[model samples]
Target: MKPRTSMVILFLLPASLFYLALFLVPAAWAFYYSAFDWSGFSDTMTFVGAGNFIRLLTEDPVFWRSFGNTLKIIFVGGFFTFSLAFLLAVLLNSGIKGKKVFRALIFMPNVIATIALTTLWAFAIYSPRSGILPNFFKLIGWEAGTKFLWMSPEHVFWSMLIAIVWINVGYFVVLILAGMDGIPLEFYEAAQLGRLSIHYGVWKTPAHLPVGLRHCHWRDDAPADCCSQYRCAPPDEARIPAILGENP
Candidate 1:
């Protein structure tokens, strides 16, 4: 084998071992446990032979409800979170004044502990009787003090989605903005050149042209510009410091 290939293998060996130990081992153990009738804390163990899986499939209403709720949250909440984050990232990246301050303020929720944020959402924001949202609703002439937000099955999923989105959108915005920042200005210029006139004194550009062109360019130069232009580091050195702050 080549010496360079040997060195690459040597470097990756530790990470491969770590993944096996931390992830694969636990996954295998879980598979084994799933086949048994172990109460998770007892000594006696019985082989269930897929009996537990059959029971869950036929008998578990709450399990099915939870699964449905999870799918609803992923599709509905994910759409809202992704759309909002993308819009915010585009606006933030548009050379807006005080963009850094806005980004920091948006990202501030990420610094707060998850449990603390959940507690605040549950008690202070959604308490229904005297909470901030209830008070706001009362001011709008609606009877908001009648229901406990988290206790009601109908509203609990939405409340959870709101909390999750509030906590997560910031992190996703940062990621999407980082990706946007990496896109070269040359592509945007090329895209602008491809603009078409739609009506009188009005020009319209195909929004997807730049992304499509970028992929085509990368495919043509797979060995060279593939990992450089589309995947190059930004010229700005302050990006990391701006995102993480100077305390680190």
Candidate 2:
């Protein structure tokens, strides 16, 4: 073939080989294994057709229950994580006092190991007999005992949800904060000006203003006046101003 095609093939060959070896091989092996009656480490293997899948579908209530529980946890955990991250991002973006300290405090949990965090959560936070929750209950005039906590299956799920939320909130907060940081300041300034004009009744149809016009409000007073006559500014000239403060 041509020299360029040869060079492209050479560049991609190693990665393609690695993927075949690591992923394709294992997946093919699993498909083969699924049709067998082999004990995973046994020397003799027998083909069992679809026996395993048939049994799983017909008589596996426990497996199905566990799968359902996993889905529940994912939905609940994702909801809490996304909501808290959005709120945290908004708080960090606001020009509030001491926001840096709060952001650091929220993000500190992400640096910790998952196993270590789970261990601490199980022993220190949810240990029904002498855990922190029990102590707090006693201090608040409630009976501090095992009966009120982890002893119940219903309560255990809530306890797990709390731990999952605590561990993941920081990471999601950082992601959303980064997204917020990437939004141009001019968009916000334009939004503010749009609101002001609406309040003073100068612009009757604020919603009808082009997005470019809304963003032009961030320019210096001179440029802003010049640009105000037009509904929208050119994209090249409508850049955001430099951020004035340190990131929290």
Candidate 3:
């Protein structure tokens, strides 16, 4: 081989092997199991020949609901997540006092353990009778969405979505805040002094999703693919499977 070709091969070989082992091989195994009649670690493996796909399409209602819920998560969830993240980023970047403390407060939720988070939300906030949400609404006398059974079968999907959005907001807040930090302070200063719309330029962050989601989903890489389709996930990354309430 030419020296240039040899050098290229040397550089590409490790990445190629890694892709084959981690990505390609696992994908091939998934495909193999898709056609099987095996019950997860059973000794016997029967070839079912497209039975899984057929059953999912024809017989499964929950799968379709989960699929629809996934779609809701992608579009609705993504829209709200990005909007809230940008809104907070803009507010924080607007020369606010004690911004460091505010930033830490926003990002702290993403650092907490997912089990603790779910428990807190379930027991403290969504406890139906004496939850913080109901008490807060009662204090304000709004009485909207506070009376519903948040963890019920009917409301669980939206409850899960809201919880996911709330926890994941901090991750995107940190991400978009980092993106905003790159903007020249002069723009924000001018906006403060002369009152301009330069802040909009800082919020244009469609390109940041891949990097943000990849870093956020590093350990929990499975949702990286699924959520990348929707365009977001929490920073802790462990809450997704549990949030979806899926089982083996």
In order of appearance, the predictions have TM-scores of: 0.68, 0.67, 0.63
The candidate 3 region of ten consecutive residues with least summed lDDT is 193-202
RMSD of each: 12.6, 8.6, 19.6
Show pairs that collide, candidate 2. Answer: none
Compose the digit string of candidate 3's lDDT tens values, residues 116-220.
Answer: 998888889888886898777778877776676788888877887888888889899999989989976544433332221123222223442224322223333
Pick by TM-score: which candidate is best?
Answer: 1
Q: Evaluate model 1: give its lDDT.
A: 0.71
What TM-score would you give candidate 1 relative to the actual structure?
Answer: 0.68
Q: lDDT ranking from best to worst? A: 3, 2, 1
For residue 213, give model 1's deviation from the true position in Å: 19
* Candidates' C-alpha lDDT: 0.71, 0.73, 0.73
Count of clashing residue pairs in every prediction: 0, 0, 0
TM-score, candidate number 3: 0.63
Badly placed stretches (over 4 Å) of model 1 are: 1-18, 144-151, 189-201, 204-248
On residues 1-248, what C-alpha lDDT tens digit does candidate 1 reach at each position?
99999999999999999999999999999989999999999999899989889888899998898899899888988998899899999999987999878888888899999899988887788887656887677787776454445537787778879888888889889889889899876545544533321121233334544432322221222234333434233233334333223333
